[model samples]
Target: MEFTQPVDSNLFDDAKVVGKPMQRIDGPLKVTGTAPYAYERNDAAPDALYGYPLGAAIGHGRITRMDAEAARSAPGVRAVVTTLEIDPLEKGINNVARLFGGAEVQHYHQAIAVVVADTFEQARAASALIEVDYEEGTPADLDLDAAFERVQGTGEPDTLVGDVEAAFRDAPHVIDQMYHTPAESHTMMEPHASTVDWSDGEEMTVWTSNQMINVNLKSIAATFGIDRERIRVESPYVGGGFGSKLWLRADAVLAALGSRAAGVPVKLALPRPMVMNNTTHRSATVQRIRLAAREDGHLTGIWHEAAAYCLPGGRGENPTAQTPIFYAGETRRVKNHVVDMPLPETADMRAPGEASGLMALEIAMDEMAEALDMDPVQFRIINDTQVDPANPDIPFSDRHFVECLERGAEAFGWSKRNTTPGEQRDGDWLIGHGVAGAYRGALVLPSGARAILDGGKLIIETDMTDIGTGSYTILAQTAAETMGMDVADVEMRLANSAFPASSGSGGQFGAPSSASGVYAACMALRDKIAGNLGIEEASFNGGRVTGGGTDMALSEINEEVSAEDAIQWGDFQKDYAMGTFGAHFVEVGVHAYTGETRVRRMLAVCDAGRIINPVTARSQVIGGMVMGVGAALSEDMALDRGRGFFANHDMANYEVAVHADIPEQEVIFLDTLDGVATPLKAKGVGELGLCGVAAAIANGLYNATGIRVRDYPLTMDKFIDRLPAV
Candidate 1:
């Protein structure tokens, strides 16, 4: 199919800005310490009071009463605002619990009160003086395996399709295995923080670190029965949010309440220890994947059952979402079973659905390939479907999954992988290799942007957040490419509620959806300019009209671009399922004595459609892959079953892959275009790189030691007991 997307051949033929190794546009400011964060925005309020948080000591219980007598008598204490003193808080749009937990404590370290003082250290000292009496209730222990038996049905409490039972009975080769993964924390560089200054009665202005600025504005305003427009939430530069900062948290609420009570602005940021349990996290899961393949090695029945624990209202949205897209099968059923637990609720993280799903599914795929005695790449190629497997009518905008696997295999040197465990030994280590396909569904959300062209420069503004994924640069590139201007001439201002709403920065939707909004405004501007030039807009693309230098002639040909021009939904996304697909190949070596698995080399090939900025795109993929390695080999939020809480709340016990633990990494992008996606024909690459990543590494461990581990982190203790009788 011919591509309708415009090519930057004139300027980017050698891939200058499109594929060049350009530094992040905002990197200098961030490194030089000029980028202001939520709690660091000193100009938002004058002489702001310092507000320190108070967390619940119990995992789950009710606060019967609180004593602020000692705190009030403290040296620098100004005021103490608890949930009892503040206006009743409304449930946030995407939040499951109240920001300040008081009546019934939801989870460990849930917010209870804030002590306002003249100094941060002084406020922190006063916060320790508030005494809270608790009426303890037996906490619903947060173990996926313990409550899995009682919880039945899928994510919606009921799920089914086709005749999976009969198909499984009739199949020749079948594999039924259970996999377990522990809960994980976002652990972003910056903690959840906010600074609020209340002025003009109920009117409040908040500087918070949040992914969705407008959501925070509306949620914060509604919390105290105030007008939605009365509260202004500004979050222009956020440090990082791996889905942890997606919505307003306790910090914002505490700051606002403290400011009002003390009659001064208050700044509040959760301490490092408080960040672990105060915010939501990636939940633990127990998944059972049963695959039945026919004698000819074709899948007949596929059953995926996932059991996870969350608060009553918390749901793992579409946990089994990837099963429908990858392969073709007649009898298939994927279900998500959730149990109500007093543990912290699970919320969205990068690649929320597929990151954990692929950790189990793709490893199962590796087992199936071995059982069928077929090459893993060939097995994937055989089961590849061009159309959506669940619904045949919805065709992929373009599916190059087969090509990704084929090209990746050749580039990854799969022939060198011996395919035999323990036989391929390298001196002090056992070496092996494995591969898994990655899939993340494409998402298109209605978005809006406003652009202004003055003189020769173009400025685009939106409420979309960057989150350290090169959002500003890519948005600039998209607007520049569309308006046919130099990239340097384009300016971007993002993450302000005064701007129009975008899809926001969840699920890797920022690049395609927000940039598409810019495309719409640019198109309208071009059309209006053509009208003033007395020329048909359709023919204006072929030539440039020159002779207007800062005069009415230039203004005559330039059109006004506003938010209204970019708010309409288009047919670009509905006609095709615009997705990004890839595969990860891993080579690992496990220590014979210590039983430590070390990744030797890694490679990934992605079909993400016309990468707008290669530098940022490459950074995203490499960073995601590193995190995947951490998930497979080291990271785990271990629970103290006796205490009914996370034992490793700090980074000391919970381990992640360090720089020494990392391996040689490489990334590849397939060249393709999809005008149906947007004017830029690009999909989000941030989270897509992580899908199916852990499975590839886990499978590589299997190849290395012949040990089939069903639990995540692949801890040394699990294999130390079973170490081949040295």
Candidate 2:
């Protein structure tokens, strides 16, 4: 089913199940601990052996020698496989660093070997017996400041409109500043894990925790030089994957190889430290933003230049992606630069580019407002653009940025904020308020699904993963609404390579695309039911089909019915610039003597089109808000410059937000629909909630202390001495 034209009217208009705040269908299983994760699938692979991986010590080096004889002869050891014994595996299309089976180490903690044994402790104990020698190479660039000067432009040097330099020179007001954000770890609850079972060297099945099952299948097949159909991947439950599980990691690869070598099923779970140093992370960025505006607060020119580290044959973060679309400007330019580095490969983390990019851009917006002597919310409202600023010829499909800001301001009590910094003192604390706008492009990918009707129950099947993002509930709502049945009658089966291919879960595209696919399949099933009953017109209601003065229970007519279809996109993107918009409002209190900052309260208003399940959507948004808080105040992966490795690799040293760190949070979603987006008319809301949150906190800190910290995490040490003496 091609989604080439806008849906004039669909079953979703009078949706009975979709728009409600339905509880997650998988909640019971998760709470009861009945759902089996990758490493806990003991029922399927009861005789599975345990595999322990050994990572390299050097960041960049060639393996000089490897001796695994001791490990092979250790107690309870069944097999030992080292990188030196196997040919280098082909890199997956979506992977940056090679997973395993390589002599040349790309970064520190790169896996070098795996030891399989009868028990996990035995495998772990035996793995330490393997010895390795390495010859280190010249150290790579480790300084972000030095790398920024020599970084080369990625793709187009810059996105240009009218004369940006001239506009900036002639403008009456200008605010120019540079900002820095350090590398961040995903730190999801579940570590990278997988269990692989090979069948007589002909086929293999892997139960793994991954975001995209079909992509994992292709990657595994490519790595082993086997037919794609010879492998199967299944992941019904994932603890969390902020984007860390989107690709094939070393755990899956090592488990597959170990199972093959030992002639038994093997399971591997990456240790916490290995999960940090061996896997991908969000790259650090240095961004320079220059905003030129008039005295009346209208933006004249916007220029954003960003440079970030990138591994060889890898794409760096584009910190200027949102600059050309967020606000209106006559002349604008966006430049992205990449510097080659020998750090662990960097990839997506939640919102990715927008999350880090907006942290700088939105704070710059606040600074510009201060220069104009205007209210920050009013400044953003004045510059709201309904069309793409870089290309005015294309208009946005649906944008309510001004609405978001206005609503958020009203809800957060913007009028009560103290305009003067350090003036609203309560004992030893100073209070202030801040606001930042959010924007992230709405993306869609072709997805397919199969719907089956059997025994008075509707079943939806797809390879889409939940990833702790509520995919199961939303897809069930889609099927129930289309088929005129209760949500309880719908059974959702997902995250299996044997099922139909779906969009998978990344970049906030999972919900809408996969739901649309389910809608298409349901529509096909409706057509088939109508044709089977020999009725020209039919309506499905109360689990019965009625047409031509004849009515019958759906289950009575047929023992089983099934249909499969895919929602294919056309030229909608070329005609419409579709994106999500939101506003973040925050209140902060700063200690006058110690310069300590704490977020007092937070509120987010979003305009991302129709929300399928408000309960799950709110959970996603609030979770993003907490992550943003962490990014603004705590999360940082400190780099060891001398050795080129992340020094704080464990959870103890890497601080994240706990219950005590977060105060009150509220999330509101505007009731909207985008016809150009999809039949579901719902854009992504998860990443949009995070886009401007960090900036709002930073802006709030500035409002309370009258000091601007360009670097991220906004730690007290950065401004402690500058604060007033006790």
Candidate 3:
């Protein structure tokens, strides 16, 4: 479809700032240690005091007895606030577990006490000294195999269409398998942190690192029984947050509470170790997938069931977000289930449902491809659905998934792949090529933004957090492109409570949803300028901000217009469905002797409409691909069932991909203009990168080996016994 003003098209097609790979705007500050992360902002803000949290040592248990004498008398200790001592702290909508001062032990390291101190070091040293006796309640068996026995019904228990059971029963060929994935960690460069200095006892200001700031502001106020209007939270720079920092985590709340108690502002940062247990972690899962197909290679039926662990208090929900709905199946039901384990609050991670689900589904597809004696790419091509079979009325906004699969296949030379595993041996290494198509909807939520035109400059402010995704640069490019000016002409002030509430940077919505807000506001400014020049708003249309019969500086328009005088838009999402698509191709070499696997190369063809900044978007996809590789190969947070805590609780044991682990990576964006998604005709490119990625790599590993392994991390240990004999 055509757009009134081709959304974000200039970014990909223009020579100014769109396609050109430029250095990041914040690169210098980051390299020189000039940028201030959350914990470091205390120096400039209304500085606060220091508070350190006292964690529950056991994973599941009640605090039977507590001793605070040593901690209270410790040097510089201001106040020792334990669970029973403080006033009730309300629950944050974004937070499933309470921030602090809670008696009931729901999960591991649930904060039961906070030691307020004059100095951070004192709080730290004293927090370690506090001792408590635990009832040592029996923790839930954390093993997935044992837990799924009583999984009962899948999540959202009953959603049915065609009879999957009868269809699979009548099918000519069937493949049923179970896949398991351990929980993983984010390990972002910075830990969870917050600095708080109250505006007054009833009010507070926190310098924090969280993806959603304004939402947290209200939640924090509600937690303390104060006015949301009284809180001012700001986070101009964030090191990185894959998904862990999305909500109002403990660091932000405990610090505020501690600061209130100390009567001086307080700063609290979760020590890297404490952050993992004190907050949340991705839950471990047990998944079982059953696929049935006809002799002609048509899928007759499919079933996906996934189970994950959570605290006894919280219900386990669907872990299978994206099942095989991408393909056309007459009878299919993808279900999710949660098992109660003595685990911490389980929440979202990047590419949540697709990430883990794909691990099993895609690999099974590879196995089915082998059973049918068909090319993996061709198998995907036949199953492509333009209109959702499950919900046939909703057509995709723009589906280039077929194009992605075909282009990716041609680019990766899939035809050259070795059909037989262990036969195409490169001396000691076996080479394999595999592909998996990615599907993720580009969602657009109502977003509002206000631009300030001050002194020949446009200061664009939104409550969106960058989260190391280069959001600021892309947003600036969108505004500058709309205003017909240089990117440098735009200044950004984002992730602050002072700004209007925004869609707050989750679900890969920043570039698409947030930039659309900026685009709307800029259009308003253009109209204001046109009116000032006596040109009818509609008269000065195409490529014309100020042209024939119109000449006026933007400064005059801002002077005459009030903030509310600016334009606002009505609901525009009804016209079309906006989404992003991509296909991931992975190459891997599994060692024949040692069963070691290393991802040799990877590529992704993405369609996220117009890439606002190619460099940043490429970085996002490549990073996501690497993360996908990690998920398929070597990333899982192991929980010590006996100890009732995470076994690899720290970075030393937790594995995330490093540069050394990655090979040459590539990403291609299908340039398109989608007005239905937004005025920018752009969609989110940040997240779709990892979606269906682990599946591709896992499928690739299977292609390299006849044995189809479904579980995640595709660990060699799991395959060593099944390896083919030379």
Q: Which numbered prediction scores highest in lDDT against the true structure?
A: 2
Worst 10 residues of 3 by lDDT: 560-569
- Look at candidate 3 and give me any clashing residue pairs: 7-680, 48-265, 49-265, 49-266, 155-336, 183-637, 442-579, 674-681
What is the RMSD of candidate 1? 3.4
Q: Rank all candidate structures by their lDDT, best first, as comma-separated numbers.
A: 2, 1, 3
lDDT of 1 by residue, 1-726 (tens): 112343334322333345445678899999999998888888667688899999887777788898888998899898898765554478777788677744787777888999999999999999899988887777455556766655644254233557889999998889999888778887788988988887345878888899887777778776677887887778888888888888778898888888888888899999866777788778888888899997677888888888777777887534566886677777788778767777766788778878888899998888898899888888888888888766778889877999999888999999878688766888888888989999987776767788777655678888888889998888887666666666787789888888878778878877878877877776666666555555553322112333233123333434453433553445535656667899999999988888988999999999887788888999999888988988998888877655456767776766767799778989999956755565566677899788888999889988888888889988788886665544
Which tens-of-lDDT digit does each residue in 1-726 have in candidate 2?
998887777778788888899899899999999989999999889999999999989989899899999999999999999998887899986788988886999899899999999999999999999889999979776888877766534456578989999999999999989999889999998999999998366789999999988888999999889998888899999999999999999999999989999999999999988898898899999998999999899999998988888678787687888988889999998888877788888988888899999999999999999999999999999999888888888999999999999899889899889898656777898887888999888998889999999988999999999988999999999998888888888999999999999999989999989999999999999888888888778898888889988798876765688999999998866788999999999999989988878899999999989999999999999999999999999999999988878989989999988898899999989969988899988887878878899999999988888888889999999988777554
Give the range of the ten consecutive residues with the poorest summed lDDT in model 1. Answer: 538-547
State candidate 3's TM-score: 0.93
In TM-score terms, which candidate is top? Answer: 2
Q: Which stretches of candidate 2 lie over 4 Å from their true place?
A: 152-156
RMSD per model, one decimal: 3.4, 1.3, 3.1
- Per-residue CA lDDT of model 3 for 247-333, tens digit only, reads 888887777767777777777888776777777667777888888888888888878777877765554434566664477778887
Candidates in order have lDDT scores of: 0.78, 0.90, 0.75
Taking all chains together, each candidate's TM-score versus the true structure is: 0.93, 0.98, 0.93
Off by over 4 Å in 3: 1-22, 152-158, 312-317, 538-548, 553-578
